[model samples]
Target: MKKTAKSLLALLALMLFSLSVSASAFAFNDIQKDPGKSYIEQLQKKGLVRGDGSGMFKPKSAITAQSAVTLIVNGFGLNIDNIRFIKEPKASDYFTKVKDNAPYAKAFIIAQLNGLDIPRDIDPNGKVTREQYAHWVYQAISKKGEYAWIEMYMTFKDEDKVTKGYMDSVQKLLIGKIASLDEKNRFRPKDAITRSEAAVILAKGITFVKNTKPVPQPEQPASPLTNVRMSSEAYGTEALKVTISAEAPHAGYGIEIANVAYKDKQAIITYRVVKPDPDRMYPQVITTVAAAVYISTAYTPVLGGEVQP
Candidate 1:
């Protein structure tokens, strides 16, 4: 009996191991020869995308607007987690065509809230053009954080065909090497972007954001404020608590640590004042407010970043 039980246990373990490997290594049968096969596979393996029901990825098919939005939103991990909604937001609130109960409706909402340039009356089922895809991908990358890019313009044979609003995104992608023009040196801006092409662009954008760091922006004139102060103290043994305090005209005005950049053994902190809600009322009285953050002991805290009005 013991010998029989051991054999059954070994068989079950082997089956589980095989299942795990198969799940991770899953690939679409039709994408083997596609130029973006590897990129598609990368996304599929990470659960950011999937093949059609029959194990085939129609690489040549034009991707719809909703699908494009869903992929970019998931691939870049965009979310509205930090946003406090007064009521449950729905797709109907922001878009005219997206159905509230549709599978991709939530993604559209997240994309819009994250600052993607989605039109209010966009047709979710309509095909997404290459220029549109490029713009959204670029905007999604921006939401991750600001990264330095070379200042240059890329000229293409069909530059005139590119929409004015999308020109900057195309140039930035080309400059970053996240995207490239065809052998004929033309970007078919109006062409409906294929699934394979979309996959490749998304994969490149994801990689770019993963390996890049936010660069500090050029200095700007500090906003005039009253009684601003900053200080740092030891937090436990390995961390430092950095704090910033400022006087506000009323309780409704507040301050927050907007960003932190670590460079040259210095933890540069940027802060912004939070504006009070327009619809809410607060006492009209002088107030002192503060915001704090903990950083590693290895770096010294320094006040940085332009204060926003």
Candidate 2:
């Protein structure tokens, strides 16, 4: 009897373990099989969605208005903190109903500005439908120049038959690369867009836009004045030393170089503004180099330089 009881207890433990394993497997599959997996994964990899405590993403679940705002913000690279909220919706305002303190307000504003915001009412507690998702995805693709004029007209108008005028416009814009007609040369516009279809369209749209964009030329090297260091040489003459520095790519940079003399100081030096380079590439090494020089100048002093209180 003792051995049998011990065996039963072991069997129960094994069953519990098996159940736990099965639950984990389900959770993992849930993320992979979600309809929004592509966007969710993209957002997750970009550090956007750190999913709630639940292991599952709950993809079929309704997205809150606030959550939608956050997704739009992170997905499209909008400034969330600095966006101003006005009581009335103006041409300049992004959202008509969103309050100043609303979460994801910046993203909502950007979406509105870019014409990507859905025309539907803002229902904070409502569930997003598959059709709505398609519309939003279509908006995103259109922003990237994926859909030709004809395709856009068809998609936006939800027409059963595309007119010749629309087709001609599409042909002009897309140059025959887009706007496919059926065997009867009829453009089917009323078809319901599927999730997989949307994914394929987005993939193609991003690729096409990127390939068609002009490649920017590398910027010219900075001159010797890129980095300037000043030191006190004498009571009347201050030596300004300059160094040229190159920076790596994708670095945040701001430059400010000024020479300020104290009110009672003997130095007559004044801050001279240098012409900013016209072809400055943002987030580049040159920007950092310029910023470093500016910072050094602010703290360094000439022989007669007076310290500010």
Candidate 3:
């Protein structure tokens, strides 16, 4: 009985040893010398990435659109947890090519709801170019939070190859060091990104989000209408000039005459507050801003609904 028990104990020990080795084994067979090995490993550990059924990452393989969107949604921890729905959302509601039963469909739905610029008919299995991935990942980052971006344009060798709409996103990624150019100072915007390269860029974006703080926007004081006055004067015409004035906290805030409506013998002048230009500087003192619109002297001038309060 003692000898039989000893044999069973030995067998159990061997089995335990094998399980331990399996758990410690590398997740993929092809990532050993890949440039993005470390990042792939990090993502694997976080459950943000996985290898093929054959235990190969295929680092040089092109990343598909579905896979890219899934990674961005998962890597950035985006979800619809906070949003309540009367009806459960489905991928088909937002995308045409994505099937409701597809594994990555939910990710696509989340991406669309978050405003990632995905087309309605995007193919899930289609390969994405470097600029395309960059644009999507940049949109994800923006949805996460707003960060202070340096006000400078980054010139690349293939600058002209970039899509006009994606220019700002590419510039932002380059400026933040989340992505870089090749030795030739080329972004290779049109080239399809490999799995390894995508992992590296995504990992960098995740790290940036984790470590960076969002810049808070300062609140502007309300623009209150101080007065609206009318006078008659224009180039050799019997016109009535209606001046709409308001008190603004800074010179940057100004009022503009949006529309003039004639009703019941009254010239109603509608005005709207023009927000301060983001790229311009202004003095931070109380200032009176005004706008004038000339109308025929046939009707009395009155302020529109917008100028009130």
Candidate 4:
């Protein structure tokens, strides 16, 4: 009886470990040695992308506009807060075949708010193209009014073959250095955005958004430099604060400290782009505004007395 009980306990532990592995990393038979394996796995871990009920992640199959938009919306963390609608919100009302409770309904609403333009007549189930996806992403970021586009001015040989209406947006993608060209310097704007390609682009967009700096401000000095706190914001406005942890109040140490941080930031941006991927055609352009984090230092008096009416 004792031996049997021990055997049962060991089997239970093995079963639990097996379940854990499946929950975290489903063994998709199709994506065993695919190039986009890492991207898909990364998204899966983030809960932004999932498999189709079964334990398969059909990596090569074409994903529809609705599904693609849903991935993009979730992957980029788009949300609605104070939106107003004249009628009851329904996907079918705005789109031709989309239903109210459909999987893509919420995504359609959120994506539209961020400048994704899927026509009412178009089928949401239709496969999304590379140019169309790039255009929508460009439109999403264009609303921010930051990040001056440094256009390469180098035209693609197959530029004319790209679909109409998406030419300008696609150009912005190249100018902003988000999408890369092939060895022949072709953007392949007319091709369908494959699952692997979509995963890579969407993942990179998350990085760009994460790299955005907040307008930083320093906490009010506690007892005049006894305690000072600062934050490095990732998104929104950019800000910086300089301080000197001097042993005595008469020290001129703040200026020396500020110069080092400023120089470090510049060196990071310059040397960071040195890694050359022959496959990547675009320059490494993070979606962020320039002229952020200007070094400024000042002394404010610490008032000990209570406020007077």
- Ranking, TM-score, top scorer first: 1, 3, 4, 2
- What C-alpha root-mean-square deviation, in Å, does candidate 1 show against the real structure? 13.8
lDDT (tens digit, per residue) of candidate 4 on 193-253: 8777777777766666567543445554332122222222233243333222212122211
Score residue 171 of candidate 3 by CA lDDT.
94
Per-residue error at 33 for model 2, in Å?
4.2
TM-score of each: 0.69, 0.37, 0.66, 0.60
Q: Give the top-scoring candidate (TM-score).
A: 1
Model 4 Cα displacement at 200 (Å)?
A: 1.4
Model 1 reaches what TM-score against the true structure? 0.69
Overall local distance difference test of candidate 3: 0.83
Q: Which stretches of candidate 2 lie above 4 Å from their native place? A: 1-29, 32-39, 78-97, 144-309
Q: Could you arrange the candidates by lDDT from highest to lowest?
A: 1, 3, 4, 2
N/CA/C clash count, model 2: 2
Instruction: Look at candidate 4 and tell me the lDDT of residue 41.
Output: 78
* lDDT (C-alpha) at residue 52 in model 1: 79
* Model 3 TM-score, 2 decimals: 0.66
